[model samples]
Target chain A: MRLFLLAAAVFALPVTALAQEADAPLELPPVVMSTEHPGEVAVEPYDRSNAHAGATPFEGTAMLEAFHGVEGIGRVVDAMIDLSIEDPRIAGTFVSHDMVRLRRVLKEQFAYILGAPVDYSGRDMATSHRDIGLQAADMGALVENLQIAMDREGVDFRAQNRFLAKLAPMKDDVVTR
Target chain B: MRHCQSIGVVASLIVATLAGPASAQMFDWVPESRAGGKLLLTGGVSTIEGSGGGGLATWAVTSGYGAEDGIGGNVHATYVNLPDYELRSWGAAASFWDRVEVSVARQEFDTGATGALLGLGSGFTFTQDIVGVKVKVLGDAVYDQDSWLPQVAVGVQHKSNDQGAIIAAVGGRDDEGTEVYVAATKLFLAQSLLVSGAVRWTDANQTGLLGFGGDRNDDVEPQFEGSVGYLLNRNLVVGAEYRTKPDNLGFAGEDDWFDVYAAYALNRHLSVTAAWVDLGSIATFEDQRGLYLSLQVGF
Candidate 1:
């Protein structure tokens, strides 16, 4: 039957590819269309894990609720991005970058780290910022913008600091230049 | 060649005038237009010794609002009214790249009416000048929150007193000396607390205003300075400081200093600090407690 022929071909495809890989190396393109997020571009496929969030999530739902759940996290991320793109000190760094992807990944990262019931699918810090040419002062400017966003969302100062403490260590991986 | 030299001199003069009075020709070296990216109060207020810190202790922070890429500077004036003496200090400090600090301070310690009682006449004053350089050697206190390691710095201060004859007559061995210190500071953001400690090696009596070394001690000794601060808000911090001093003078015993202070930043460019200080003993006078007030302004 035609269905049996199709199934046989589907099973044989992987065997053919494995035989080719044994004979030579596969040359994968560096960037490709993101099959997971249609509108975003992605690098060569990698595993998706909560470890990509860079910091461990808080133990309970208290931190999540303090940030007003996922909605508040989304607002803070958007505002931080908007402010950073306009801020003269670091605006140039954001130019020509994939902001669409940045916004989604950042929102997911923040929500996941704040103890939301969500997993991050973004690249690790070192991989994402490898070519940004960032400096220590650029990180400072970003933190300032983030603080402004959190302040506007009515987050308590102590709670804000607790979250900042989590992200502080990521500077080692984020500031490559 | 003479004509070309004259033209070059004229061009330099014009550029200097356009750069303003405070920073003439500085633009020639610094082309970066941006300045002041640091968070508020992160530079700390100017210390009595003109370094960045609390009232009596020198912290590991740089002296200004400059970020890691820019430059910042400040000038401060401090006055202390004590039971037996009055102390006035004024100074300026500049931080470059938030890595190195240079500062200069002048202290005038007036005997006031106590001068007459000590047979030195009224208003007899001892003056001293201190030049200091501090270089940050390790982590950052503000940003490195996840680690227990603190920001550390090492500094040297050279001090010279004007009254060498009076110092020698009072059992002091020298009027000029140098001090070296290492300071460590940390900010526990989760608790809104800051802690700083320092150890200085010196033989100065009364912080070199009464001169260095003395008949009783001529060797450099290590003394400790510590501070603890609690942040009430973004603009306000309350703290206490304790500093130990060497008892090098045979004529009078030197005691440790203590202060409880409050510092408030009105904005990025201006701040005020007030404290109740206990200087312990000066000369033969004891229980020398007083009010301390200081004002700082910068970029």
Candidate 2:
């Protein structure tokens, strides 16, 4: 039926933006199993095995350098705080707070987390914000602000996700509400 | 009447998709502990052979992007119009925790004019039902993006043909058999690419159309299926698949299956896939190539 054929149009639109006619082909990595003779599965946790002793970093620290420097960290903090307060979900919470202190503390915290050079002497995050009456929405707003800040800082998507993955674990300890 | 019914089903599906969930609440059901519906197009569309894959190969991904302890599923209807035959199938599958998946599909293979030439009644149809289950064995295809680890799974498909009498008359060994396969799938997020490979031990003739095994070869053999997918965008996937099949019945030669497809996920709830499929030959017909279209809706 003509009606059925019409559904194909969805893919036809913006044809020019799709991948090129030819794409780079993918090849399967070589097999590493029983070459001539091997054995069965005696699997254990990697950390409990001898392989754990040889832990090595596959990548370098050059990626974290983007969030380095006083100017970069300042801009990053400014973007995060500015957007966080501007977000309606969290705006009321920051109204009576000292903006200067929050900014300084956040900068120090981020610097510490990213392994940059900064001295932050604020109470631990969980203890400091425990009475703020934060909700899931507030945490979401914070993540949104952080992601937007990373984008404004020209951090590529992959790098942003990588950094976020490291920071993502803090949600459990920070959000008791 | 059946044609009208099928169309009505599709029409109702479209309405349900539009009225169901707004984009903001798409992943709201997932717990805050895990990010669900974050992976882009991880669940490849249902294949012609009634499993979750590109066109023929089965990927290790458990059919959806639902995170740990979450659930996901979809319903799909596919129609393939080839030069010598027409095929249509309806199926549904669900994945839990991205670990286990179960699916069922009913396939109709219409041997139109070719049926009369072979002394069968006009529009002779070969029908079959396929039920499949797969369990993820290892690795994370998406989250482990920085590593070379690929997700792997082992699965089984039990297929039953309705035309047992006619199938045996064509020299087929049986009308029911199970296919065992192991598949590995990997997603390279940075490169926006996905690759999958599968090895299946089967003796089904033309995927159990004429039936399983035959006078020519009765032993089970290893066949290969492979696929490569390119993420044109977060919602769009273009891929190609290749599946080498078994040649059981000496009545006709079976060629490998190939297809190039583009799958578009309008949102987390609805998707459509269209492809050009080539299932080389069937019976005495040669070059049975055609177009395939499928639609899927789910959370």
Candidate 3:
């Protein structure tokens, strides 16, 4: 009876632990050799710069105000990422990826590009998407999701297009396939 | 009994681990089968001549919502009601990989009371068929925002008019001909504007409804088409187009075509276009101006 109990306990151990892990936040533990954002997985070491945002920021705060500042930018990024992760055309690209870090970096990148008070600290576009094998169609899917997210945020259509124009040049770097 | 329990526990542990990874594998990154990915209005509306473009000018954009990894096609019907004549056309176009486009169209030019005045009976109709192919040569109009270079394409259109006797009576040299063109298109997203231009070499008189070449001019001449559009929103674009036509027939003068137009996408699969167009004159009838309406359905 004791031996059976011991075996049962052994079997229950990892299962219980896995259930707990599933309930916990998905942030991975940081690696020892890299700069880490809170609640984000460690990434390979690379020089980080605002230039990693891949586009020049607008000249004035009007664009930032149109996006409702960094807070709105955060919401937009989160919604866009969530939609894209759920979209059948593009959800596969987000699978098994470190979404926590992606959400944070995308928020920063969008805030910086919209002329908000933020600096992007992420890898450049080409380096970040190096292995994703994104085609023009994939990029188009993401853009559609982003548009929906922005529309939900009540951003003016013209303002949204102006913002998209700034990001459009990065297609060369993002669509490697 | 203890040995059995131990083995069962080992198996359960193995199952748990395998199941964890399997759940993580719920969504696999399948590399194939992506479609319907082009942005709204990026494909442009079908033209009267059966290519993708503004109402009159042929832009370099392909025919449908297909992106580089997919296929898209559409069918369109257009009608132009002029003062002295009515023109109707229906066509279909398909795009592959956003690289190649194939299209076919049929046009009917009907002269109402003007046919009786010209002594060709009342309600005379000239029918023509066009088949065209366009290949995207380089660049992307929508995505390449940093560059001034526009998306460019080369195309050929073969036209056959059915009224051979009437064409010869109008001093036409042939009832069939071929036209070649090069087109460039660009979208300035910041300015919410799109621009396109094409140069066509053709001897087709009145776009081949009156037939190809003529007694006065039997040589194909270069003609220009230009369009400029401003995007009002994601689904609406307002533009103007100008197209120069060859005056090959000695018996009648041909005039350039122009239109101020608006195109709206009801969704990715459907769109409508309306314009006020001026075709100047048809045959000996002068001041042919009226409404142009077109309907397109596709994906």
Candidate 4:
């Protein structure tokens, strides 16, 4: 009987320890624990959670301010339009019709630049110029005029070039003469 | 024994040294011109090189936008400087799925008849309307994970001279023609460069808009265009391109031209570009040099 009790004690001790272990919180892989879902098995909170929750103050507001800084783009757009009209190089190229188009185009351009909701409904550029004889020299003048306008607006040279690069493919259609 | 140990150590050291850098360099051949779901604004001045007998040099500005999912559109305006005349043009384009693009444009080439050649005096305008379509047959220049060849595309431009009566009087045949072209473009990310090359075949006469007045056989000639650029950063690129135009004139040959250009990206929403060009000559005229600049803004 004493021997049985000794064996029973050993077995009971092991079972009790196992039950305690089963109730204990689990230690998961770092990635798995880091991505803990609400429905996942409960786990002991790691120290990292304290650091994660202690995010910088006003982070959302800071981001909003940074975005608002781009609002200056409106001034740049206005400057561009003014420069187009004031600069003789580009001004000479514009017809009365082009001026009307310019106003609408600049307005839409600024709205989009400022991340405002807008849709462009301007006439097709090619169709508009069908009657006007365009020469390569004219294209050169227009390009120079644009550069001057950009320069006045404080647009960096590299930023200006990025904008120009997107327009290169239209040479085939635009240079009809 | 010491020598063997030294060799083993050296081998391990070498392996360690190469492993990290090799893994880093594994992404070299991937194409960088991916569809970023934002508008792409590109423009430049290009001269017709020496391919089309002799032609005039010109400057042009163009703008384009890419929709969120590979759908996009573009527009362009250009001016050409001739010795005795000036020309102007504008165009627009739409791209679908980044695999196909269609465009329609108009051009007006004015020849001031100062010299007493034809009874018509100065202000003789040659106008043309063009419809174009391009389809990518193979390769994606912007999204190849690993490849050396650039993105290849085939396209066609159909031109119709709006001044049919004027063209007919000048001995033109219907004032319409078709031009077919194939182009390839690639961006070298490590070098911050983009390169494009193209060959075009056309049935248009030298009097591009005027058509052929004589019984000249339609010439199917190959034209070439190429661009080389240095990327300043992710948003800005400055480049140069050389384009060869087809000589459509049966008489009074034309000379080709080339352009040097610079471009800038303002943000995800806007960009601009400028270029200086040398348009060789049209027929006997010379000294056709000019500049081009444009601005583009999109969502």
TM-score of chain A of 1: 0.79
* Pick by DockQ: 1 or 3, better one: 3
- lDDT by residue (B167-231, candidate 4, tens digit) is 56544556777777776766543344667777767545442655533334445677676667776
Question: Candidate 2, which segments miss by more than 4 Å at Cα?
Answer: A1-177, B1-38
Q: Is candidate 3 or candidate 4 better by DockQ?
A: 3
Off by over 4 Å in 3: A1-36, B1-33
TM-score of 2: 0.66
lDDT ranking of the models: 3, 1, 2, 4
TM-score against native, each model: 0.83, 0.66, 0.85, 0.49
Q: Once model 4 is optimally superposed onto the true structure by TM-score, how far is the C-alpha of residue B240 displaced, in angstroms?
A: 2.4
Q: Write the per-residue lDDT of candidate 4 for residues A2-32, one digit (tens) a residue.
A: 0112223444565676677566653323422
Kindly list the per-residue Cα lDDT of model 3 for residues B15-114, writing each as its tens digit. Answer: 3343333422422443443446699989999998889999899999999877887777777878899999999887778888899999988888888788
Candidate 2 structure quality by residue, lDDT tens digits, B98-202: 788888777888888878887777799888889999889997666565468888999999999999999889899899999999999987765667899999999
Interface RMSD of 1: 1.8
Top candidate (DockQ): 3
Best-to-worst DockQ order: 3, 1, 2, 4
Residue A62, model 2: Cα distance from true site in angstroms: 12
lDDT of 2 by residue, A1-177 (tens): 001112134344356347546565433233233332243112221222212111122144444576645567678889988988787656866764546556765666665555554445445555556666655345545766786787788766665555554454455445565
All candidates' lDDT scores? 0.83, 0.70, 0.85, 0.47
Writing each residue's lDDT as its tens digit, candidate 1 over B1-299 gives 23533543464354234323343234237755235657778888888888999978999999877777667677777889999999988777888888999998878888999999988889998889899999999998988878899999999999999999999999999999999999999989877889999999999998898999999989999999999998877788999999999999988999999999999988667789999999999998999999999987775
Give me the candidate number with maximum TM-score: 3
